[model samples]
Target: MRVIEAPSPNHEPRAAGVPLDTVVVHYTGMPTAAQAIDRLRDPAAKVSAHYLIETGGRVLRLVPEGRRAWHAGVACWQGLSDINSRSIGIELVNRGHAWGYHPFPESQLESLRVLLADILARYGIPPARVLGHSDVAPERKTDPGELFPWRTLAAHGLAVWPDPVQPPAETPPVAWFQARLAAVGYCTPQSGRLDDATAAVLAAFQRRFRPKAVTAAPDTGTAARLMGLTASA
Candidate 1:
């Protein structure tokens, strides 16, 4: 793999032999890739990803894959609190939801697929481990939002996808839905009430796994999909 290092001074060594098992994908949310790169390389910014993929499909290495990049701040996954120590972070260039969020370009996605395939193969990261930033910090972040094409990634064996009809219309009640969300590693409460936090979690989940229609309410299709995904996982 040919690479050029644009080293950032914002990262450090992983907490001694922490096995890498996750891949956190994100968007720069800036107006341009150059600005994103500048921010990432700025020590004062205190943020950096191992790699950044520009809109034109250019991949820039900001930190060595073996080192822990300071990207996933205060995040968790499947009981693991120190996510940066166990994952490689990739920042894709996009305006993000805050600005004029748009679909990722074709060239960029193709490049992303190639990079992700290599990473998944070399590290043996599971399909379930390929996740979005929002999945790790649903309460505060939502980069690589609903516009990201997760289904395309899954089709190439880079991630997992829920059944097209798992949570049939005749499925059980809200408790069942809540349980499935929890099972899939979402920080959803089991209260059976679809409150704001619950809705945000559900939306984040959909944005990563579903990506077609991210509604707040747990409808028949959404419930079925969540149940199917949990069972598969």
Candidate 2:
């Protein structure tokens, strides 16, 4: 593979004794791939991903897979912390929501699949480990949003996809929904009330796993999907 040069200075050696087994995917969320690349390379920005896949499928390696890139900040997964040291980060190029967000190109996704397959095979990353920026940091971020083709990646065995069954028409109780979401590893509070934070987390979960319907409210369909995902995981 033709490797690109490092584009960011905000990285360091992986935390000692931390086993690397996760891969976090993200979108540049900038106006253009070039601009995103520049920002990642800027030391003052204090942020960088291991790889940046451009719209036409060009893959740029900003940081070595073995090092800790500053991609996932203040994140958590599966009760584990320090996600930066435990995951490989891939930043897909896209003008994100703030700058006229658009669908990721087919070529870019194909490249992502190929890269993810290779990474998974080499690192032995579990299906649940293949996640999004929002999955680890739901409160502060939403890049690689609902439009991301996670189902396509799942079809290629890169990630997990919840069942397509929609829940019954009558809305399930809030407690039932919160419990299911919490079971799925989301940072959902135990409170039965569906507050804004809960909605954000639910929306983030839907954006990653159940893209077809991502309403903030815990409808029957979202609840059912969350239950299926947790069970399968």
Candidate 3:
């Protein structure tokens, strides 16, 4: 795949012996790609992604894969913090929720598919490890949000998508949902009640798997989707 060099200085060495096993996908929340790219490249911003894919399919490399980009700040996944050291961040050019949330273009997604395939193969990253920025930082982020076509990526083996399943005859409790979500790699709380933190994580999960309705309510459909994902996992 062709990529343009647009290196950023906001990176540092990864922690010793850390394997880059995760890929966190994000959308540039700025109104324009130029603004987003400029901010990422600026040292004062102290944030950069490994790569950025533009709306028209152009790929730009902002940080070397060997270094830890300053993305994924204050994020956690599967009980692990310091996600930036363990992940490669790819930013998609889109007016995210802050601007005008919309679907990703086919051109952008095509470039992402090619790039993701190459990254996964080279690093031995599993499809399950490919996640949205919201997935890792549920309470603080929503980019690469519900509009992202995860099912399309899953079709190409670049991501995970669960099949539809029937909800249990009797609706499960909050702890059950917590267990299933944690099993699916979300840093969900195991508190017996649906607390704020747990609700945020559940909303993030719904943003990915049940995009049509992200009410964050522990409804039957959401429960079934969680069941399907955990069973497949």
Best by TM-score: 3
Model 1 scores a TM of 0.93
TM-score between candidate 2 and the true structure: 0.93
Residue 30, candidate 1: C-alpha displacement in angstroms: 0.5
Model 1 over residues 119-225: C-alpha lDDT tens digits? Answer: 99999998888989998887789988988888888899888788766457575666777777778877677888777777878788877766788776677777767
Model 2, global lDDT: 0.85
| Cα deviation of 4, candidate 3, in Å | 0.3
lDDT per residue, candidate 2, 17-88, as tens digits? 999999999999988888999999998899999999998988999998888999989987766779999999
Off by over 4 Å in 2: none
> Which residue segments of model 1 deviate by more than 4 Å?
170-172
Cα lDDT tens digits for candidate 3, 1-233: 99999999999999998788999999999999999999999999999999999999999999999999988999998899989999999999998987898789899999999999999999999999999999999999997999999989999999988887898887789998899999998999888898999999989999999999998878888889887787767
Q: What lDDT does the true structure give each of the candidates?
A: 0.85, 0.85, 0.93
- Best model number under lDDT: 3
TM-score of each: 0.93, 0.93, 0.98
